[model samples]
Target chain A: MSEKLKRFASNNKQLLIMIGVIAVVFIILSLTVPSFATIRNLTNLLQMIAPIAVMACGATYVLVIGGMDISNPSVMAASAVFGVYCMTTLGVNLVLGTIIIILTGAFLGLINGFAIAKLKMVPMVVTLSMMTIGTGLATILSGTRGLPRLPDSFSEFFNKTAVIIILLAVMLIMDFILTRTKFGRKLYYIGNNARTTKVSGIDSESIIMLTYVISGVCAGIAGVINTASIGTARANMGPQSQILDIISAAVIGGVSTSGGSGRVRDAVLGAFLVCGLTNVMNLLNVSDYYTTLIKGGIIIGAMGIASFRQQQAAKKGV
Target chain B: MKRILAIVLALVMVFALVACGQQAAPAGGSNQSTSQQGSAGSPKQDIAEAAPAEKPAETELKHVKMGLAMQSLQAAAFHAWADYLAYRLDYEAEQRGYEVELVTLNADNDVTKQATDIRDLIAQGCEVIFCPCLDSQAILSSVKEVHDAGLIYVSYCREVSHDAQGDEVPDLTVNFASEEQAYAGMVDLFNIMKEDGVEPVKLIDCYGDKTDENAHNREHGLRRAMEEFGYADLPVVEVECGHWEPDVCGQNLAPVLAANPDANCMYSSSDFLNSGIQKAMEDAGMWHKHGEEGHVYFSASDMYPLGIQHLREGYMDTAVDQGCYNFAVHAAAGAFDLLEGKEVEPVQLVLGTQATYKDIEEILATIPLWGNDYADY
Candidate 1:
């Protein structure tokens, strides 16, 4: 048992250290902020983090496959709006509306995927431009208005518990694809070394684009849940700032932003850790500016820890 | 693996297409209570047209906590709302001899997050929730959700009210932050200009985001006043759109100042853009106190802390106080009334004060400015 524990610790040093840091933050917040540790606060915190975590789950694929997507914010809004617009204006039933929303995300993701994979555009620039375009498209679709008066959800995706369930499902499925599928292995290979992946006879481009489509599908699911829970579709949804939260969660949860290894579970943990701070600050009556500053500090601290661990490993010739 | 992926993709799209066909067929309906958007983003329906929503059936307060959710605290006025709401709730608790804790959250302009924030408030055991509805149409379902949960939901300045559609959703809305607030300021500022020997004021309408409803409302108010004051035919100078944030507002206004060197009487959408306006004015050697040479008459809406200071020190001409503090105070009182199961007005009105340097002190005497009252906070 000790030997197995030692081997796991040795292999996942960064994750172990991250868990420690997260635990410390949890303990400190629980000690200082009144009711921070209460079941109600934690449950509410779960509700708050669900959509963000789900978004992060999709983002894990992008990051693991050596990509970055800033466009998720606008993509989220545009897709959600189109879906709801179809439901309310186009007279699509709730099921069709929900599917349309996912398809919209998939379509946008396809554009992103095609650009980065086929045209070989820079991931950040392509996604950033896509973000602005998505925002504009959302405004146009909703006529720069909120799309509310939504019909009853066709799926079991509404309510607080349902949102959390959706998050869990997304996390498991994304994790399974990454850890247990031939598709995920190809993604890791492309992320680790494109040249090597090509030399190894892997159809990296197709896999890369497919991964983006999957990311889009995840985003669509998130949109459906948001529209259901929010009961309104606006051009500006939660993804505006949540994109950053998603990225931070991925990085903090030990998903390498520089490409290579990542886990959906780790991304979920990252979302919890990042969002928990906001929850704690609100409860304590602390300002959001402070929360932003602290989050930045934590990210930097996370990077510093990763760098330090690498240095220690190199010194020991591990 | 590719075959599996292809099959899954094919099946999903096929299902979506079939679902599209299913929309026309009468489907199994669930008894839903949530609402949707009315206009673009702002509530387009007239307040008078909105029939009072029937209160959520048999809903009862579960907890003793009160909540105030703001659209965003990036604007100073919302911060004031949070502070004043807390203070007002505390004051109410003292008067009522029962403590009701406060839970405040900011959606940061994200409507979906606002939903989650409302849910959190519900989970935090808040009995009543107050918000300056970010999207009037977007918040209808949330209003229903709150009422269904046996809690009270109160909103201010709704543009897309479900009540107008005759929904059974009984969400009380406060009538604050309206065009009337801006029109009142324009009228008052002109009178002040007459009294201070700055009469015959030629107005330069400094625009905000052209797409924003607030900008249009304030500009319309200014235009209405200009027409009333006999300056309706002024050629509209197009200013750079700032999107209502300080950094962007200031950056955009710089070029406008450079172009109109002798432009006088700059009226903006909101004094929340005062920082940007002040920065540009000071840079162009145009910023001066009242009676100072190169002093451009500055009138705007939502007299935030800086706007109040600008008015107090005679740097600004007029500030259309949107009654943020007043609205919050009333909302807090309304929440208390709802908590005690007392009958309350569905549409409560809190008239805003059009404060100028001359009348600000007098107005301050009667009205509580949250910025001034909770400045230390």
Candidate 2:
């Protein structure tokens, strides 16, 4: 048991550190801010964090496979607008609307994958272009005035608890696939060294493309969840600012942007940490400008500690 | 290749589905062309049927095509204004027996996009263009283009800054006395606080987005009110820049409340920010409606539906209404004058109304609330 515990600690040192940071933030907020540690506030925080956490799960895969998708927000907006139109205007069933939303996101992801894997284009550039295209298409479909209020029953069915359950299920399934599946193993191998994986007769491009598709699907799910939460499908639903939070959460949770390393679970932890900071700051009535400064400082501090730990581990390995 | 082909086929299927859905249920009340036959009658008869009007010859009413370039429809208030404006113009044109084509575009808060939208409206043969510019200075070139085309340029809500090259100024500008209205609202709230015996009022100023011209004007108005009320040197416990977002306002107000737990009042630039302030205050156990113990007096502008509801519930002390109906009516009237070569009056028109909890019902009945249905208008 001791040896196993040691192994777990060694494997997830960064995650452990991030968890520690979250606990410290919670303790400080609880001590200083009245009602900060209440069940009501925590539940509110959970609901607020759900959409970003859902998207981070898919972003984890993209980061692990040596790619970046800055267009996830646009994907969310497009899918959400499309989904709302189907449900509200077309009078499509809830199940079909949900399917259309996910499919729209997956299609966008497929384009990004095709360009990067098959066409040999840069991931950042391709996704950036895709982002513009997605936003434009969303505006055209929904117009400036987004889809009106969805049916109450539809929103009631996808309530806060339902969203939380879906997020948990996604995290568990993604973590399992990443740790236990052959497909997941190839992603890491390709991310670490694509040339080596190719020489060993593995299809690296196919795996990379699949990762993008998974990311796209995740973004689509997030869009649906956001639409339900807000009760309106805005054309500019997923502002780029929120995307920055997701990326920051993923990186802080120990999903290395350099790729080839990280776990799906890390994304959740990162999301909690980011959300917790905002929640505590708001509870404490901290000025937003100062909160922004503090958030930046904490991110940098966390990254610095991570780098230091990595250097020490490298030295010990030598 | 098969995989790629499959992906392409799937995308095409998605687009086809969207197209079908669009056709099945057309969008409602969008600013599109609606053909209306001119009433075959004398000019005097047509003019009499329309609202209190100076009759222009039927020939002078050249099938007026108007364009409105809105900054963004993200905010419900802005969307309500744009929708009502379109409806009002359409109704007016139909009444006047003129073929009117209304083209409205949302710039999504991008200055460059707003400029492009203006140029596109001109190309679409818009005889009169009204834009609430995203960037006052950046839209000068587009305004110049509108002038060069001999089309009437009307600035709404925001005043466009004239270029150094001395290009043609806007034919007319219409806006609310934003600063004075905000100031009046604040002063009214202050009076309430004083009456309640909340001495030594420690106030928090939650201003609007710094980039917005109205925000600057409103802030000046608040200062002016403070000066007039002999509260210029009053203890301003905290000043938060909400940027017109409730979330940002909540975040900014939370810490201020913690530090100044006894803060008696708040002056927010708009109802959107007040909503955030209310939420934060409630969470902090500092929220109380007027006449209740520990009530935090609040003043705001843009008497949107939410603001009016807050007033009805006695949560707000006062709110200023930038009358959307009046704004649209005035702008449309100005466009008509320019189109028919009628003598135009003062270049700038300021309009607004202030409401309080005491007269909330009367105000609601008088003005169109945000999210009001077009049919109701």
| Model 1 DockQ class | incorrect
TM-score (chain A only) for the predictions, listed in order: 0.90, 0.94
TM-score, per-candidate, Cα-based = 0.75, 0.52
Residues B1-377, model 2: lDDT tens digits: 32233234333323332333233211114523222123221122333456545645667664867878888776766765675566666556755666575666666564434654565566556799998876554455567668877788888777765331345478887777788878889888777767776764688878666545677788898889888888888878645553367887888888898899877877888886666777888889987777888878888888766777788889888988766656676777777777778867635545456788888887556444442322222
Model 2 TM-score on a 0 to 1 scale: 0.52
Which docking class does model 2 fall in? incorrect
lDDT of each: 0.69, 0.71
Question: Model 2 over residues A1-318: C-alpha lDDT tens digits?
Answer: 999999998777666665665665566556755556666566557766777888888888998888898889889888888888888888988889989999999989988898999898999999889889888777677742235556557667887689889889999999999989998898888877888999999987888788888889998998888776545465556766666778877887777677777788888988887756655444433432245566566656555544554455557972
Highest TM-score model number: 1
iRMS for all predictions? 19.0, 23.3
**Model 2 chain A: which ten-residue window has the lowest total lDDT?**
A280-289
Off by over 4 Å in 1: A1-47, A89-93, A140-144, A154-157, A160-162, A280-290, A293-318, B1-63, B156-171, B175-177, B189-243, B246-267, B277-298, B308-316, B357-377
Weakest 10 consecutive residues, lDDT, candidate 1 chain B? B27-36
Best by DockQ: 1
The numbered model that scores best in lDDT is 2
